[model samples]
Target: MSEETVRSAKGRMGSFSFEGESAEGLLRIGEVTKSTGLTARTLRYWEEIGLISPIDHIENRERRYSGKVLERIDVIRRLQEVLGLSLAEVKAVLEQEDRLLEVVSRYRKDLDSGTRLVMLTEAKRANDEIVKRLDDRLSEIGRFRMERVERGQRIDSAIEQILREAND
Candidate 1:
């Protein structure tokens, strides 16, 4: 198998780890930037904005990030790209990340135990039902409008014929 496939399999098996990849339980700023696919300047800017902070500093005085920082980066990316949250909103959410992760973890545990149904499935069903209803309503409205237009045309024809007879 390819190296990437082998790594994926190892990761799935929980044997592969990202620990110590960083500098002394903290990743170097460059490593974080590379791992996250974000630019170094962006990471620094985020730090300046108080959106993310490094966990430690090395002897060389370089910033280092912890595992939590990696998680935060992922959250930031998701909030911006998937949820369409603005930078300010993403920052606000990051402030509440711990609580959100706790809640999500509880729900995930419940789902794994089959105790709580996945809300996503229910939401999709409800959305499909609403779309079907809207389509039906639109079709009904179109048919009603067409009937009214036809009736008005018939009335106009009758009025024209009546006027013609009166004149004759």
Candidate 2:
């Protein structure tokens, strides 16, 4: 082949790429297979299993994948290869992960607000009890003082009567 014809054939076969024509992250099924090192059949099987979903569709009915799909693929790959988890177990784990995070967030909020309320209530109750006890003790002391004063008056009146009789 001539030099120019060979170069044109290579360019047609995607050997040479311009800036705008290169689809790196925005990949269709073939590119996704190449980038992920996964077979097209495996990708379709994973989709069938509900492990990952395509991000969008092209005008020609091609599925377009995004970075999110790539991340999910990585997770699925790890779960299968490294963790030795079955597809069902991986799906269940992912679902449980979301639920656990939600529950933890709610518990944290409840702990913060409920703990503050409980502490405030306990402190107020303690203060109220202390004030009530002090009031009762003060009232008892007042009654005891009044009774002693009345008894002293009676003794002084008796002494006065005795002195008047002596003088008469």
Candidate 2 deviant stretches above 4 angstroms: 1-24, 58-60, 98-168
For candidate 2, write residues 1-168 as lDDT tens digits.
234433443444443223343333445677668667899898888887878776655467766554456777887787668555678867765555445445555555665777756655655554555455446556866798899999999999999999999999
What would the per-residue lDDT of candidate 1 be over residues 5-72, giving only the tens digit for each residue? 33443343332223345233345676667667899899989988988987755456767566567778
Query: Lowest summed lDDT over 10 consecutive residues: which window, candidate 2?
Result: 15-24
- What TM-scores do the predictions have? 0.44, 0.43
| lDDT (Cα, 0-100) at 54 in candidate 2 | 66
After superposition on all CA atoms, what RMSD does each candidate show versus the true structure?
A: 13.4, 31.3
Model 1 stretches astray by more than 4 angstroms: 1-24, 57-60, 99-168
Q: What C-alpha lDDT do the candidate models reach, one value each? A: 0.64, 0.63
Listed per model in order, the count of residue pairs whose N, CA or C atoms clash below 3 Å is 0, 0
